[model samples]
Target: MELFAYYRSTSSYRVRIALALKGLDALVVPINLLSGEHRQPAYRAINPQGRVPALRTDEGSVLIQSPAIIEYLEECYPAVPLLSQSLVTRAHERAVAALVACDIHPLHNVSVLNQLRQLGQDEEQVAQWIGHWITQGLAAIEQLIGDSDYCFGSEPGLADVYLIPQLYAAERFNVSLAAYPRIARVAALAEQHPAFIKAHPANQPDTPT
Candidate 1:
């Protein structure tokens, strides 16, 4: 298995954490998103969406998008289950993940920030744009986590991994985390889990660039 990724990409970080948690040995093929390599003809042929976190399966098929890839992983390797068996619990977990992936991540992605700059927005405004969405999203997450060690409880679940990278991204923008104590606590809990720790931006190969 080969996972096409950009180390600092939050979507890629999600897959990386899940793969690590499942003890899967997938090769990490880093894409240089800063260099626009993901949009180049070569990678575009592999994933037409031109996104990071594209996975090439053992059967030589390509899988795109974080949600689909993560679902496939949970199904194919069920040992270390990320989603709970309880129906309501699973739904709530999905809701929390969606709050970050669908609502928060899209607003603050690299492309969105670039578009803001293209529209004559300065760095300060760009930073504020990121912080605003994250602040709102984390406020919801704070209520969702509610002082739990993990987002869903003692065991790390899909919500925890999904939320951590976004928190890291928020940290990059110097977003104040003080308002969401529960979110902060959950992220701290994730740090103690090796799956989440290994996928941290600081631990990635391309971080210092």
Candidate 2:
């Protein structure tokens, strides 16, 4: 398997965590998003959406979107399940993942922030925009998650996989996690977990010095 990813992209980070948790090895194909590599025709051929985290499977099939690739990973690699077997618990886990994936992350995505800049929003305004959405989303997640070592349970599952990357993004944008103690605890736990450590943006092949 090959994973085309931008080291700093939260979406890519999520997928990397999932793969590592499953003990899967995939060649990391670095796509320099800052250098506009993702916008080139070569990457567009892999994912017309031109986004990072496209997975090319061993069978020679390419899967686009972090959600779809992750779902595929979950289905294909069931030994280390990222979700619970109970239907209700699975739904809850997915909900937490969606809060970050669908609700919070997109609003502050590079494309969205670029659009805001084009619309005359200054850097301060963009920073404020990132802070507001991340704080709101994380505050809700803090309430939703239980008092455990990881999000929703003692084991790192789907929610942890999603949450850790968002926390990284939060730190990157200077959004404080001090207000969310449960979230902070999860982050603290993840800091020591081998999978999380291996998947960290700082540890990625494309990470800048």
Candidate 3:
């Protein structure tokens, strides 16, 4: 298997941690997003969306989208389960994951920041835009994580995967973490885990700003 990824991408980071935790290995193809390598036709052939975190498997098939590829991994390698077998618990896990993936990430993706500049927004205003969504989304997650070690409960589930990446972005933007004690604690615990620590951007071979 091969993973085409941008080292600093939070979405890609989640998948990297997951892969490492499952004790699986994949060839890492680093896409230099800052240099527009993802926009090139050669990379686009692998993913028409021209996005990073594309996973190519042994059968010569490609999997796009972080969540889809992750779900595939969960199905294929269930030994180190990231989900609960119970339906209710799984729903709760997905809910927490979506809160970050669908809400927080899209608001602060590179395209949104670029668009903000296109609309005559300065760096300060662009930062405010990113902060607004992050605080709003993280506030709810902080509350959820406050009562439990993981998203649903004591085990590290899907929510932890999504939450750690969002927290990384929050730190990058210098978002105030004062009000997110629960989140901070959760991310702190996750970082101590070898998989999360090893999969960090700084540890990646091709880390770019």
Candidate 4:
């Protein structure tokens, strides 16, 4: 398998964490988003959406979108299940993941931030936009998650896969996690998890010095 990804992209980061947790090895094909590599025709061919985190499987099938790719990974590699057996628990885990992936992350995505700047929003305004959404989403997640080591449970699962990258994005945007202690606790626990460590943006092949 080959993963075409941008090191700093939170979506890519989520997929990397999922892959690591599954103990799967895929060659990292660095796509420099900053350099506009993802917009090029070459990458567009892989994913017409022209985004990072496109996974080319061993069978020569390409998977796009982090959420879809993650679902595929969960189905294909069921040994290390990301979701729980109970339907209710699985729904709860997916809800937290969606709160990060669908609600929070999109607002502060590179494209959205660029659009904000184009619409006459200054850097300070852009920062505020990112902070506002992230804080609101995380605050809700903090209340939704249990007092477990990980979100919803002791083991790192779907929620942890999504939350950790969002936390990284929060730190990048200078959003304080101090207000969300449960979220902070999960982040602290993830720091010691080998899968999270291995999948961290700082440890990626394309990470800048």
Candidate 5:
């Protein structure tokens, strides 16, 4: 197995956490998103979408997109289940994950912000654009989580995988996590989990010194 990823890519970070939690051994190949390596022709052939977090499975097929790849992992390896067994509970977990992966993360993606700059938005405006969406999303997640230790249960599940990365991205933009105490609490606990610790951006091979 081989994972093409960027250390700071939130999407890639989600997969990294999942892999670690499952105790899977896969070669990690860094894709420098900052330097547009993901957009290069060679990488584009590997992932037509030109995004990081593409996984080459043992079967020789490649999977792109973080959510889909994670689902595949869950299906193929059920030992460390990330989704809940209860039907309603599983749905809610997916919803929470989508809340961050779909609704929030995209608005603040690098390409999206670059488009804002292309349209003449200055640095402050771009930052505000990113913050506004995150603030709204975090507010909703705060309500959804209430006082849960993890997003869905005592153990970190799919929601926690998605939430942790979004929180990391939020801190990068200097977004105030104070308003969402529940999220902050959950994030703090997750940051200490062995799997999460190994998957942290600071610990990645490509992370700059």
Candidate 6:
């Protein structure tokens, strides 16, 4: 298996954490998003969406989108389950993961922020836009989450995988995590977990010095 990823990408980070938790190993192929490598013809052929974290499976299948990739991993390798078998609990976990990946993330991804700039928004204004959405999303997540060690329970699961990466993005953009103590606490605990430690952006081969 091969994973094409950009180290700092929140979406890619989610898959990395999932893979580590399942004790799966894949060749890391770094796609430098900052250098526009994803826009090139070769990468576009691999992933028509031209996104990071495209997984080339041992079966010669290519998977795109972080959520879909994670889902595939979950189905194929269920030993270390990231989701509960209970329908309700699974739905709840999926919702929490979607809250970050879908609602909060898309609004401020590189493409969207670049679009905002093209439409006459300055850098600071674009940053404010990112910060606003992240704050709003985290506030909602705080309300939904209980006083558990991870997002849904004592063990790290799907929501924790999603949350940790978003927190990394939040900290990178200077989004005020001070308002969400529950989130802060969960992320701090996740950092200490071996899987998460291995999946961190700083530990990735593509991370810039």
What are the clash counts of all predictions, listed in order?
A: 0, 0, 0, 0, 0, 0
Worst 10 residues of 4 by lDDT: 145-154
Instruction: Report the alpha-carbon TM-score of model 2 versus the true structure.
Output: 0.99
16-131, model 6: which lDDT tens digit per residue? 99999999999999999989999999999999988898999999999999999999999999999999777887888888999999999999898999899999999999989999
lDDT tens readout by residue for model 3, 51-170: 989999888899999999889999999999998888987887888889999999999999989998999999999999999999999888876653677566676778888888888899
TM-score for candidate 1, residues paired by index: 0.95
* Over 4 Å off, model 4: none
In model 6, the Cα lDDT at residue 12 comes to: 93
- Which regions in candidate 3 have their CA more than 4 angstroms from the true location? none
Per-residue lDDT over 6-72 for candidate 5, one digit per residue giving the tens place of the 0 to 100 score: 9999999999999998889789999998888989999999999999899999998999999999999
Q: Least lDDT summed over 10 consecutive residues: which range in candidate 2?
A: 145-154
- Record all residue pairs in model 3 with backbone atoms less than 3 Å apart, i.e. clashing: none
lDDT for 63 in candidate 5 is 100
Model 2, 41-94: lDDT tens digits are: 999999999998899999999998898999999999999999988899899999
TM-score of each: 0.95, 0.99, 0.95, 0.99, 0.97, 0.97
- Give the per-residue Cα lDDT of candidate 6 at 59: 100
lDDT of 5 at 149: 81
How many pairs in model 1 have backbone atoms within 3 A of each other, for residues 3 or more apart or on separate chains, i.e. clashes?
A: 0
For residues 37-144, write the lDDT of model 1, one tens digit per residue: 999999999999999999999999999999999999999999999998889889889999999999999999988989999999999999888888999998887887
RMSD of each: 1.4, 0.7, 1.4, 0.6, 0.9, 0.9
Question: Whole-model Cα lDDT per candidate?
Answer: 0.88, 0.95, 0.88, 0.95, 0.92, 0.92
Q: Name the candidate, 1 or 2, with the larger TM-score value.
A: 2
